[model samples]
Target: MSSRLYILLLVLLIATGGCRRGTDAPGIPEYDFMPLEAGRYRIYDVQETQYARNTLPLQHSYRLKETVGPAYTDVSGHRAYRLLRYRQTSNSLSWQPDSIWSVRLVNNEVIRTENGRDFVSLLYPVSNGLRWNGNRYNLWQSEEYEARNVGQPFSVSGKEFGETVTVIASNDSTLIGQTKRVDIYAHQIGMIYKERTYLQFCTDTPACLGKNQIEYGIRQIYRIQTYGKE
Candidate 1:
């Protein structure tokens, strides 16, 4: 086991799947899908629906901004980026800090941490219809994510992207409730659109017999508004 041999093997690992980043090349494989750089930011329009039993559903709209602050080595010795999230409700309202999250690339997969929960966002060689467990790294129930509509053109907020990929995180529905989570990413841009729903409906009664009547739940959508480097 010589130093030269070890170094060679390490280089091969990196070239294969160690990290999605190398020397900032024009086309850096998966980097286009999950870009990780400092000072880059994106603004999104958010819509949420809340429901409660015996009450009308409440609709809320707001704006969210996510900025990549800086890169630092994490406990696992991998380079990670600090993600800062801001929220605003109205044009007159100033952006306020909402939360702090982190994103890192391990091997060939992208991991994003939110609220102390790790979720695998994407993997290398992103082929259409590829599936993987997004919660494999965390101590949670196994949740599968499938990549669809790869290398397709999409439009959002009057912006047209030549290439995009959609990840179906969850899709389940029953007579009583439904839970669906989806995210769309554009080439050179990050996540362009996101939608999630977790709703429970009425049951065992005439009014709630079909379970179509909502009892309580939450639905949310996020659409990209503006994005650029700072």
Candidate 2:
């Protein structure tokens, strides 16, 4: 072979090798905040506090267990996973059926539907400061949800998680203050903690006959006690 032809072939080989390396490079790290598989379940200790208009705050504690059921197609033709929720009061030994929740991953986004309302739980390429409308399809209220403290260490219920993502959902404005809902998800596991607090009290001095005049509100807290997959 001619010297120029040999040099040309060598150049082509180098270019091809570079292209191959570029194609074989490692992809973006997968954030397993929500691993959807059958038989995966998580148990949580839940505390619910209710604040009525003219009544004192009442608190109730319970145990909540959620399990992933079989996969199925929904009415909208999307492949979805069923979640069975069970709850047990403090004095109850047997768990009672609370409700059934459904979720699906579409276009790399986790979508959950409850009570005919669709919510975008998590988005792809999960990173800090990621924001989305969690209640976009809901008619009652539009909530702005943001991902904060992504891939951060978190501890709850005597367990330490290497990486956790916290999503905060809040309404624009309310009668009293901002209504916020927070969810914390651990890597390789699902949600480990959740909190929702909303309180509206009568601020007007004349309308407020007493100092404890809460119109309506509720506070809920859930902490993961244990989780496993099968």
Candidate 3:
């Protein structure tokens, strides 16, 4: 390669390196925050809110159960687990089939596929302020995510976890809209809580302009209700 081209290639590699963090340290329970144990499942209480231009924010609640299956080698040669999800409208109602996802851990980086989208859920060696691109494996543009509050006590939905870590997946704000996603995982237990907000405000009306009122958007919260192995 030409000298100029070689320098350019080196710069490109360095730039994309931040998209994924390299970690080979020995694993621990804290690193297993999202365990892949087969037959284990987690139940969550889902609180959803939807907003429209003229309607009051609609509120809906439900329950979700995510179950993991035995490990199998994927086409890419990575060991992956099947994730089957179910939904329940109420405690009295039986669980209905929801969706299927997949989870794989490669070099201490947790890769989860949800609805055909790939995302790096969590990174190993759980340290504070560690950042990586959650969308590095997919074709989508780089989306920065950071680990924070590592190995700290957290409480959610009346359940207190002795130690937990938070992943700030996305946080973007603008005059017209705002989008944010955060998830907390406890030691040995998977995700204990998750919250997401995608909001768009009215910019056409003077009264609501710059006020950031929810003209239309969706906000969802998932908190752990119970969990155990099947």
Best by lDDT: 3
**Candidate 1 lDDT by residue in tens digits, 1-230:** 99999999999987877355544444447436879899999999999999998888899999999999899999989989989999999979899999999999887788999998889999877989899999998886899999999999888889898899999999999888999999999987899999999999898688676758888899999999999999
Give the Å shift of residue 134 in candidate 2.
Answer: 1.5
On the 0 to 100 scale, the lDDT of residue 83 in model 1 is 96
Candidate 1 vs. true structure, TM-score: 0.87
- Clashing residue pairs in all predictions, respectively, total 0, 0, 0
Which tens-of-lDDT digit does each residue in 1-230 have in candidate 3? 89999999999998777554444433443467898889999999999999998888899999999999889999999999999999999999999999999998898789999998889999897899999999998996898999999889999889899888999998888889999999999988999999999999889978888889888999999999999999
**Candidates by TM-score, descending order:** 1, 3, 2
lDDT of each: 0.90, 0.84, 0.91
Residue 14 lDDT (model 1)? 76
- Candidate 1 C-alpha error for residue 120, in Å: 0.5
For residue 85, what is the lDDT in candidate 3?
Answer: 95
lDDT minimum window of 10 residues, candidate 1: 18-27
Two-way TM-score contest, 1 vs 2, winner:
1
